[model samples]
Target: MDPCNRFRMFLVPFVMGIAFIFADVSQALALRCTALSGDDRYSILYTVQAMHQAKIQRQGALITVFEIGGGDPALNGALLYIRIEHNDQAFVWKTGLNVHSIQQLSTGPENTLDIRAKEDFLDSNNMVISREVSYKIHFYLNNDTLEDAIFVENSPKIN
Candidate 1:
């Protein structure tokens, strides 16, 4: 084989290999969220409960994550810049500005946020929800302050 042709052939495969690796990595980035529901209200406005420690994990992986959430009732928009901090971690996670459009909390339930496990919670695009892990959720009632953070425990209901 000519030296120039051989070099070209190697380069093509090298680039193709790199591209394939990236494609596989990207495929791991997926969000698997469960449906949540609850009917709670706030004094000033009103609040509803969503999923509890809902785990969004990679199909065959594990991730360190905490479910933090917030939404505005007055503006009827997802309240961003709200505070969300972990008990063991010092860094705080700011709530995203995306919410469902509906007037008043529904009698039924709905999915709040699509929980996806990721390598870094600080980066949205790096998430890959793990389906093997379970999530825990906390609930709370809002009056006029943001100090109230309610956490609920999920257990097998006894009929």
Candidate 2:
């Protein structure tokens, strides 16, 4: 085997490996917001996280989980009024929970809310996709008065 040919073969694999590493790093650099909406007295918090899962005989998939909660220093066991609208779907909840309280409207508590997209959906080189999801959250006091209204337009991409 020629010495130059051997080096060329090794170089190709090494460069491919570096590209994959950079892609992974770019994905990790994506912004992640855990705080959604809040007011002077109360707040409506949200968290979004993604995880990649492998499937048998199929391309891997990305699963995103969403968690929403109500928070206030003066809640003191007071019932909170929360309304969440995702992609025009509405969910309402009233609870006396604190900041750590998480409510999953569509799915079970253990499952929570999630959006799944193909692993290849993201364009690594471009880094500009045309996919987005919208959300609206409203926080209210036990007295039936609105505390804060949060409207998110074209939030993080789903694809």
Candidate 3:
């Protein structure tokens, strides 16, 4: 091959590789996350709870929620930040507006997420004063994202 042809061949593949790299980066950057406004409501202690993917059987391929700063298993006022992965994209929703001691995490009806927990009634100082009620909150998972959560029980609003 002539010198010009050899140089052209090398340049073409290099340019193609660079383009491929940029495409992959853009795809990763396409993760759409909801507003994490009140994420600082909880303490810094976060515990990772990884669930079995086959059990849920939803649009999310992997689901993980980090438990934030609650020690007592009985009346702990813990918060959660959920992360869902689907189709190589990730979505996060901060479940931190209320005080909950997560008792169970499982699949709910209609392919939703079932988070069974005891609601902690906190005093003005963010201390758990009472654990009077339990709640079952359902998080709807769509094709590429998790929808707004719905809950039945009324808990003290965290500011």
Provide backbone clash counts, one per model.
12, 0, 0
Tens digit per residue, CA lDDT, model 3, 106-159? 655654445555554434454556543333334455655655443332322222
- Which candidate do you rate higher for TM-score, 2 or 3? 3
Off by over 4 Å in 2: 31-115, 120-159
* Residue pairs with clashing backbones, model 2: none
Candidate 2 — what's its lDDT?
A: 0.31
Every candidate's lDDT: 0.28, 0.31, 0.48
The digit string of per-residue lDDT tens for model 1 on 58-133 reads 1111112222235333222332122222322121122322232211211112212223221111113433322221
TM-scores of the models, in the order given? 0.22, 0.25, 0.44
TM-score of 1: 0.22
RMSD, each candidate, Å?
A: 16.3, 18.4, 19.5
Better of 1 and 2 by lDDT: 2
Residues 1-159 of candidate 2 have per-residue lDDT tens digits of 999999999999789768756754543332322223335113333321211221111211112222333222222111223343333333334322212222222221221222222222225563423322222222222233222332221214332
Q: Local error of candidate 1 at 143, Å?
A: 16
Q: Which number leads on TM-score?
A: 3
